[model samples]
Target: MIARLVARTFGLSIAVTVAALVVAYLYGGPAALFVCAILAILEISLSFDNAVMNATVLQRMNAFWQKMFLTVGVLIAVFGMRVLFPLVIVWAVAGLAPAAALDLALNPPAVETADQPSYQTIMVQAHPQIAALGGMFLLLIFLNYAFDEDRRVWGRFVEHWLARLGRVRHAAIIVALAVLLICAQIVDPAHRSSVLTSGVIGILLYLSIQGLTAMFDDDELPDTLDPAVPDPSSTRPAERDRPAHLPVGGKAAFMLFLYLEMLDASFSFDGVIGAFAITSDPILIALGLGFIGAMFVRSITVFLVRAGTLTEYRYLENGAHWAIGALAAVLLVSLKVEVNEVISGLVGVVFIVAAMISSIRANRADARAATQTAAGVSGP
Candidate 1:
């Protein structure tokens, strides 16, 4: 039953993605197709780590929440974030007329903007700051995960009080933002909209959105596991008689979905901005990169499920975690300095590749151990 459901859900997603691409193709020509393809790859490359992060939560969710996740979750990603979100950003940052951006998207310029690096070049030139933003965000996330200890550098400072206020659940995120706004006001009132402020806002916004969704969703944490779970592997004579492992409940699954989206948002930040750096057209960005990219992600998700990659390729999970960290670091750096996307991609890919090798090594070790035990038992 579970297998059938997985197949159907994945199939539906593929169909939708294809339909979207077809529409974009009909609306625009080969340029649209090319853009879509590039965006799809970019999105997939950026989101590989995101999927594993999601699975960690999704594996724990029940069927109902799982369905809601793919449905509502896709809508938010495709439309809210992918389409309208960038336009909003451009309006805020470039102070360009949204209508003009819309027109540019509908009728993209003959030449790829990257070929003419006036505005795009300037953005790319800020690569160091971009890398800084991404890098810092990733480091913070990694530290939050890897470290248990939260220390204070200053002795009972006022900022610490604000930081404590920042921990007050969902509301704390807003408080943090307000505090950042106040500081920006005091320190650099003239350039409050600088990259530094943008970075802080982006991080805080990401946190706030994720925290709120989890807090609001009742099924974010399920109460019970599915009855159809398979038995867990056990070797101890007494443990061998233990009951089967329980599957994730609906609520848990929902939470997992939320978690995945949050991670996805974090991973996509640079890619989205980088793409905009490539072409300022919102429509082109959405159609070229948004719809097509979404399709690829859906395909990858299905592939992982069918191939049992998540289970078999367990090291991929570790790789993705590290990738997230790398991406975060890239983001933080991008804020204050400039860095190339290639460098960011390289940092993440290195971590993922290392993790993949580690996973393969661990699997081989497990197999060897099992073989040795079998040989000993048979010999005796």
Candidate 2:
């Protein structure tokens, strides 16, 4: 069962590993291979939560859309965000031409030895803006989940209260704005405007995507009621009678794809910045962190869907969202304070593991109660 769950990912993982090694060899020989391997591991460790979150959404999608995520989606993730996005940033910030930006990325100046500013220097300088955008995006994701009053499963009392407060109009947006304002004050004065603007853009991007999804979505309730629990005034249908899942057509599917890409980009922001700490070679970064890590994530997403893990572990989604909240907070705080990547990764793992344990205990308790009820019925 375990082997089948991860079988698809295994093939892609081997392919990505081979590709990374070959690229590493061509770029900087054996030493580069070791670096690539380490970066790949780092990316995977940091992105396990990302995989879970992806699965949460991806499972809702049709098989065609799921395949698109693995194929076309991978290209967007690897080349679009990992490769071209950095060049675009450098181009915009450093006022370098596209070719020059690419050249700088490919042949980054040595931090200690170079006399002039390099790609890494410029990228680091832009960390405040990057962090703000990614943080705000992630913050909204957490807030949306927290504020979902209809959500039946919850991990904390605060979440329940927050959901209750969701009844207020635009409560999530207001809270997000307030947090963004607080974060802006924590950043350097020079970067204050950039941070605020990027954060607002993040919020706008999220709202825009959500609006688009709502507009494009075509699902509607069934016209009839369930016969099992008949009631003349009943306005609701039984859970089993309702559609198993919302059918996503082409437009809605496309919007979901775009949403996934944006989410991946937000997650990648820190990893991309952190990769500089390892090596500033754009090609190597794409091969090791981008290609290999992304494939593994996609594989894991597929595994989760096939294994029905989300359905089995009811609280797992809550755990992922909680991890996202923690990550968002860390990203925002990182604007003012340096945070270790290990700490960030570990925090996410802790939340997910805790939720998993809670789910396990709940399942066991339910089983014991069922056994008792069955025995009582039989004895009588």
Candidate 3:
């Protein structure tokens, strides 16, 4: 069973990694190959929480949409975001022509000067906008989760307060806007307007995606709570009994697909910037981060869903959101400060690990209680 699961989930990623490594060697020899390996590991480490977050939404989608996310979605992640998006950003930010931008990316200057900044220099220059946009979007995600009234407060003393705040209308929005304003204030005056604009765009984009999702989403609650006792008021047609997780095609699936892509992009933004720290070659960075890193991350998402890991490990999703909150804060702070990539990645791992330990203890306590109850009822 375990072997089959590994093969099913990781087979494609394994296959792709081998081929990419060969390409990496031919492109820049053993040093490049080593860098490529390091990058893949970094991406996977930093993105484990991203995979968990993806699985949460992916599980609600149908098989077709899930497959689409792995195949078509990853392609967009690689070529669109990984390859083309940075070029476009460089073009717009540097006021370079399209061809010039591509040329600069492909053949970046070996040394930096005022008139001739390398691709890495330019990408670093653009980090503030990238952070503002991606950070705002991810921050809102964490805020929403923190304020979810239905969430069980398992992790912290503050959660009781956060849950109460959920009762306040638009609490998440108010908090997000306040955070955005603070970030704007911290940023340099010349870039404050751009940062604010990027932050607002992120907010609008998230709202638009959520709006589209709700419009096309099936409103019926999942039957998992008590499948044997069906809710009569369910809107599902009597003749068309279907699994709640299936049939999420058409517009709803499309919206989900879009959201998943954006999530990947947001998570990738800082990683991409950090990759330049490893090596400034844009092509090399994309080869390592996009093809290898993204492929494994997608496989990990599939693995999590197939194993039912999220449902099995009760606090996993919550942990991922908390990690995301940490990431958002890091991203926003990174706009004006130099945050280490290792520190950012470690913050997520700590939250996830702590949540896992807490979940195990909770499970053990529940099992003991169940045993005691059963023993008493049977007069043991």
Decreasing TM-score order of the candidates: 3, 2, 1
RMSD of 3: 4.9
Q: Give the Å error, residue 313, model 3.
A: 0.1
TM-score against native, each model: 0.66, 0.91, 0.91
Reference-based TM-score, model 1: 0.66
Task: For candidate 3, give the lDDT.
Answer: 0.84
Q: Lowest lDDT 10-mer window, candidate 3? A: 226-235
Model 1: lDDT equals 0.56
- The TM-score that candidate 3 achieves is 0.91
Per-model CA lDDT versus the true structure = 0.56, 0.82, 0.84
The residue pairs in collision within model 2 are none
Q: How many clashes in each candidate?
A: 46, 0, 0
Residue lDDT tens for model 1, 12-70: 65675677668657767777756665666666676656666665445445566655666
Put down candidate 3 lDDT per residue, 77-149, tens digits, no spaces. 8888777878888887888876888788778787879899877788888888999999999998899889886
Model 2 lDDT tens row, 10-62: 78788878977898888899988888888888888888889899999886677
RMSD of each: 8.9, 4.0, 4.9
Residue 228, model 3, lDDT? 34
